[model samples]
Target chain A: MRRWLARVGALTAAAVLIAATAPIIMADDLTVTRGAGDGGVAREREIRDIKSEIHRLEQRVDQLENENGQLKKSNAELKQNADKLQTSTTQQLSEIQSRASAPPSPADFMDAMNRFLGRYRFTLVGGAAGSYIYDRKSNTNTFALDLEPIILWQLSDKLLFEGTIEANLPAGSSADYQLPVADFQYFLNDYAELVMGIFDQPFGDWYEDQSPFWVNRFITAPLPYNVGSLIPPTEVGLQLRGGFQWGEMGQVADYTIWSGNGPGYTNATCGSNTPPSPLPDCSTTTALVGDTLVSDNNIRLNTHSPGFGGRFRVYPLPADSNFGRLELGASTFDGKWLDGFWLTSWGVDFNYFRDNLQARGEWIQTYRQMPQGLGADNRQGWYVQAGYFLTGLQVPLLPSELDQYIDRLEPLIRYSGINQRATVLGNVITTPGIGFTGSPALYAPHAREVAVGLDYWFAPSIVWQNELDLELPRAGGFYSDTGQAVGAYPNDRAFVSQFAVGF
Target chain B: MSRLIKFGMMAALAAIALVPLAPRHARAAEMTPAQQKRQMFRRGAQLWPIYCNTCHNARPGGEFSPTEWNMIIMHMRTQANLPPQDANAILEYLKASR
Candidate 1:
């Protein structure tokens, strides 16, 4: 704007010069044509007239220049105002956007409650499972259903809470109940942690999230971890665990240890002596009465026991795309039976996973020293299972197929074995109130079985599992609910189906 | 002399109780993904009693970022219903770790 005004001023001065000179040149041309029409006095008068006209033009230019200067000042102010407004608008827009999207930090936790000023989470996990088991006493097939509803929430970072409500669909029996497995862990670093409340004591590969059916080629968790009735899981207490990453040592090597209230598995047993070999409820009174078969801790050790367990894992060729994981773990529980005598159970477990071809198995032995006259019960069992995904088993599917049912469909088979001497694995204690004492032997009559399952993960969050199981009895392999050496081994066949969601 | 004696006693207590805590506080430790993730939120939610579990019921998605949520929760940690770590885990679990 300032420069424009300067140009206007220069143009005005030049126009005045031209206007004043043009008349003189015209007068000279006239004098040449009129042949000296007037003397010096008339020529001089014409020149003065031209000068007067130039003066009037100069006055007009001065007036125009003053008006033009005022106009430029106004234009400059308007431009300045416009620029300021644009800057203000841009700043306001950025402020609004910043308030809308990004979390207050480099990392953010957002869910329904995250939007609000509190910690919150809502989860619903409802699924059904059917199991087919062959019982030697009934010599018939038995089918049962398992339905579970899951709710997990976080009120803050240091705390976590999860509740699972389970029920049997058809009967809607009292089998359904709510259990809270909430924990608060203190983080010392990225690798070590301390936890309190009810949580799984990290014992071995099987005790963690490793599902017998989903991992590598194994169709089942090995004998030692599952049956020792020993590897206590999900306890209510405190746990201290740390993970060490040794780049110079190996690619994937981790260790975890936990010491807490060692609780047995769902409806499981933690017995040192025979839980008074639960009598065969084969009796007609299936309806549970008031505490006739209540658990009688035969040993002096209280039902609430103290135990510590750990797992060590090593990955061979860690940096390589194709590698294997070798894990070895062990656990022990010392508790008494109803008779109040000390009894101890200890077991070792192992599992190996390599790509799609995976194999896992564990061997565990349980010994029972009966109080007074009753002979000591000593037994151990182990099962090794290997499975391969027929469809490039280990390799994850393409991006598009990730959520489809076909991606989860894999054919798997596994085999497990047990020692008859380890009667605890096969014996079922009849809890007068809870029905069957969660002894493994009563639910499983045969010592060994080969199971093949067809699995389909319908979606990343939903899994549909089906397994056809074949239990073969060795020539002498046979036991009744009484733990009696039965006449001969009888085989059982059935199919089991399950659904699970992780969200 | 009595004030000096009191200071000495206090200093002695501090020296004894703070020895183990000093190392852990000065240096942050490393943890497994599950542990790293599962533990920090636990420590962060130490405030819940005075903040949550009053009239605003904890449904599904209740409140706060894992970081900010920790602040609101640390204020209410001691309540029996909303223990610090337990409350924090409930919130962190709902929020995506990513």
Candidate 2:
């Protein structure tokens, strides 16, 4: 039994060993078979397929490694580029900050000022004159100096301010100062302007256009434009004036309408006592027409109503025609001088310019209704003037210096007259006190004058003028302040020389 | 008479106020800048003597600087009651001559 058991154990062990070795033997046998037949070929084909896949996988792994290396290199390059960009940006920023803070130079300031002043302007312009006068009737020789300064301020395209001051100084007399013009003008449109303030009344062309010393060809004004004339020299109020093209033929028309303080009358009653030497006697009542620069109608007669007037002028011919410019104008001013009395004045004027010749004329009529059935006071004045420049004359025979002066010469002639029908106080007129030699002639009932003048222009605005006048008065006489009747009015001859400069 | 005068003044003022509202003539065709400048110069040349000679002799353009001419023209504009177009034309003529 022991032997059998031992043999069984051995067999068992052998069996176990065989059992383990049998699969190896069979795998060896199977490999041998696969290598030798169709199944072996199929097994070899499968191995080949697996090996090809392994080769492909190896190639993919190599490709992935190369791509990863390239990506790392690109990342490094991008970091370098970013660092360079940041450095450049920092340098540029520093340079820009360095130039921002600095002071402007003078040239820069001037440029700025020029830019600012291009639209607004302020200027000063004026006229100055000196004159020598010899009056035959007064038997007096006098010297006078006059200065007129005009200030202009252009605030904007449509707004402007203009002011003029007239200063006159005469030998042996106090200096006279007057504000002739001070006004603000606003342009409403191309054809209209609204003016406010004290301005030369648009009664006639002479006062508004040619009254300045440098502008007037003669030294003395026309008869109608003298002090206390039919028309007021200036008015304080509002005016609308402008010019417009009238027709396609180049004709033009201008108009001015105004409302302001007109004229007033002062009724001075002689005192009960025999008046002072210069004062008129109590028997005759003197009425003074108060139309001076400082007299306002409201203040003089307590009349609250304002004066209404207008002037309309038309140029019938083409303004640019070789025939020259001809203007016809009509003006009317009507207002109440007293509670129930009215002072009405109207004027017609004409101006003609051709080549070197200028001709102008004015006719004015004034009617003042008297109170207490005193009837009406009528005054009429007219003046016609002409000036011709000697530019067309060729004086080759004269010396060069004289010829030049002659070429600059202008000959002027004027015929002026005034007719006062009746005195304010019936047929008897009281003459004002004799403050100067020619005071009586100023109140003449009928006066006529013929003036001849010659003007030498040093420049367009500078001239030396000389004028001679022959005055003739009507037969009527006036009562002096002493209540004495003075005989026929005196005829006088006067001469005036003036040097004027306008700028 | 006073009432008549007041009424006339009111009518005149009303007329003046209504002038801008009145229908204006149709403008010509659009002008080139050069053409417009030429037209302005021509008009100014025509008006220079007509307006300036009315008061005094026409001053030489060289008598004043361009800026000075501006102020002077502004003064004369109001003094002479020249329309804006006419004044501008005169100014342009003066500046160009200068």
The chain A TM-scores for the candidates, taken one by one, are 0.59, 0.69
TM-score of 2: 0.73
- Model 2: TM-score for chain B: 0.80
Error of 1 at A341 (Å): 5.4
Segments in model 2 whose C-alpha atoms lie over 4 Å from true places: A1-120, A266-302, A396-401, A421-443, A473-489, B1-17, B21-29
lDDT per prediction?
Answer: 0.44, 0.70
Candidate 2 lDDT by residue in tens digits, A116-233 = 8775477778889888877665666777788889888888878889999877775666887778788898888877788998888877887778788888888877767653467767
Residue A17 miss distance in model 2 (angstroms): 62
lDDT by residue (A60-159, candidate 1, tens digit) is 7677779878998999999999999999999999998997886654343344335674533444433445444443433444445555554445544444
Cand. 1 Cα-lDDT: 0.44
The 10 consecutive residues of candidate 2 chain A with the worst lDDT sum are A429-438
Interface RMSD of each: 15.2, 2.6
Error of 1 at B11 (Å): 30
Best by lDDT: 2
Tens digits of per-residue lDDT for model 1, B1-98: 63244335434533332233322323235556677665655542422211221111122333334444443333223111132234445456535432
